[model samples]
Target: MMQTRRKKLSEWVQQLYFIGPSLFFFSLIVLIPFVMGMYYAFTNWNGVSNEVTWVGLDNFVTIFTGDENFANSFGFTVRFTITAVVLTNAVGFGLALLLTRSIRTKNALRTIFFLPNVIGGLLLGFIWQFIFIKGFSAVGDATGIGFFNLPWLGDAQTGFWGIVIVSVWQGAGYLMVIYIAGLINIPSELMEAADIDGANFVQKLKNIIIPLIMPAVTVCLFLTISNSFKVFDVVYSLTRGGPYKSTEPVTMDIYFEAFTNNRMGLGAAKALIFFLIVAAITLIQVVITKRKEVQS
Candidate 1:
């Protein structure tokens, strides 16, 4: 019994040696900050001020009940999340399907499609900003049509669409890569057997491909949903939540509350709430998708 206990102790010591550094870093970076943020969420911390006073649930109440902008930002975030999730997944899956085929230019096309995702969001925003501001007018003049000349970032609806367009363009490629992995993982023999059984393309896709790739769909959906909810850089660079805060999303709102308005406590509260909302959404999605995956 003494020998056995010594062996187990030695094994545990070895394991701890390997894990100690990572645990230390994790505690410093994530755990500590999370605990501090949670604590500060209930206080009135003006960020730079030396004094922080406990304010209880005042920030929460203010955000949900008093602040009109918070509600507006929340509404905008919901709308953007829904639209972005749908469009990003649809386009991504479509690209995956296209690139999965054996074509001469498949590799080049894949590279081209994925290139946008590699670009920085802020840079992409600036590029699109130029397009909306200058390139659109040039197209309008050349085509003798006013379609491209509309004030994209200057109007509320147009700014919202502009954000969506940039988001879809930037994200679709990454999601496509995920979908491609899922698509390629499906057994070719299954598809061949389906074809042998006189299964048409649509029938094979609906019955075989969709079900088999349900896991990929779930991953893509989760990524898109989370990304859409937390989108900040692109919106900030492009519109700055302008046109009367029409395009302001939740993340942007939280950022402004924290830094610009110097309301760290309120901002922290908003962030906690945002985190909860995203966590709940992701959990629900995971549950539903995992069920579908099991059924498939």
Candidate 2:
């Protein structure tokens, strides 16, 4: 019994050795801040001040009742997330399908497509900003194509679409890599069986390829949804939550509330609400998609 206890203690020590740093940092960085943020959410603590007064639920009440910016930003985030998730996954899957075919230039094409994803979101947004504001104009003048001549970031509608386009352009390539991995994992025997059964391309895609790739689909959708919902760097670099704050997402709203307006408590409340909404939505998505994966 003493030897067994010593062995168990040694095992425990080894486990701690492996997990100690991760647990320590997670507690220091995420867990503690999360709890403190919750506390701040219930108070009126303007950041950088020592005095914190309890305001109960007033901050949340005011947000739900009177904060137009929060509502608008929430709407913007939802729309952008939905649009980006759909377009990014669809384009990524399509590219994966095309490139998985026997082709001579696919390697080069894959590299070209994935190159944009290598750049940081802020830098990519800045690059696209210049293209939208200047390069598009130059191209328009030379080619006289009205599609390229529209004001890309001059208004709310254009600004929203601009964000979507930028997200899809930068995101699809990364997702394509994931889909390519999924495609390559599919057994050759399954494709041979489908061909023997006289399945058409669309039929095979619907019946076999898609179902088999559901795990990758779930991962890509979750990633796109989270990234799109939490979008800030791109929005900051590209449009700075303009024109007239039409492009602001919930993250930017929280940032301005905390830093710009110096209402840290209210910002914390907004952030907590944002976290809940995002968590719920992503959880639901994962649950549903996981179920589909099991069924498939």
Candidate 3:
């Protein structure tokens, strides 16, 4: 019994040795701040002031009742998330299908496509900003194409689409890599059997390839949804949530509330609400997709 206790103690020490540093930093950086933020959410603590007055649910009530900017930002975020998620996944899956074939340039094309994802979001946004403002204008003038001639970022509608385009361009490549991994793992025997059974490309895709790739689909959808919802750096660098704040996401709204407006307590409330919303949406998505995976 003493030897067994000693062994258990030794195992505990080894586990602590491995996990202690990471847990300590996580507590300091994430857990503690999160707890403190929850506390601040109930107080009226202007960021710079030491006087924190407890306001109970006032911040939350104001947010739900009268915060027009927050509502507007949330609306924009929802629309952007929907549009970006669909386009990014479609393009990514399409590219994955094309690249997985027997092609001479597949490797090079994969690398080129994925290159944009590696670039910093701020830098990518700036590069695309210049392209939309200057390069598109020059191309429009040269080609006389009405599509290219439209103001890409000058108005609310165009500004919204501009962000969507950049987001899709940046995200699709990374998702393509995920799809490629899924595609490559599918057994060759399955394809051979489908061909032997005289299954057409579309039929085989519907029945076999897609079902088998459901795990990758679930991952890709979750990633795109969360990333699109939390988008900030790209919007910041590209539009600064502008064309009259038409492109502002909830993240930017929280940021301005906290730092720019100095309403730290209110900002914390907004953040908590945002976290709950995002968590619920992502959770639902995962649950639905996981069901699909199981059925497949």
Off by over 4 Å in 1: 294-296
Say what the RMSD of model 2 is.
1.2
Instruction: Give per-residue CA lDDT, model 2, range 40-153, as digits (tens).
Output: 999998899899999999999999999999999999998999899999999999999999999999999999989989899899899999999999999999999997888898
Q: Tell me how many residue pairs clash in candidate 2.
A: 0
- Can you write out model 3's per-residue Cα lDDT over 26-98, one digit (the tens) per residue? 9999999999999999999989978999999999999999999999999999999999999999999999999
Give lDDT tens digits, candidate 1, residues 215-241.
Answer: 998899999999999999999999999
Residue 3 Cα positional deviation in candidate 1, in Å, after optimal superposition: 2.7
Model 3, stretches more than 4 Å misplaced?
Answer: 294-296
Q: Residue 43: error of model 2 in Å?
A: 0.9
TM-score quality measure for candidate 2: 0.97
Whole-model Cα lDDT of every candidate shown, in order:
0.94, 0.94, 0.95
| Per-candidate alpha-carbon RMSD to the true structure | 1.4, 1.2, 1.2
Each prediction's TM-score versus the true structure: 0.96, 0.97, 0.97
Model 3 TM-score? 0.97
* Candidate 3: clashing pairs of residues: none
Angstrom error of the Cα, residue 106, model 1: value is 0.9
lDDT score at residue 86, model 1, on the 0-100 scale: 97
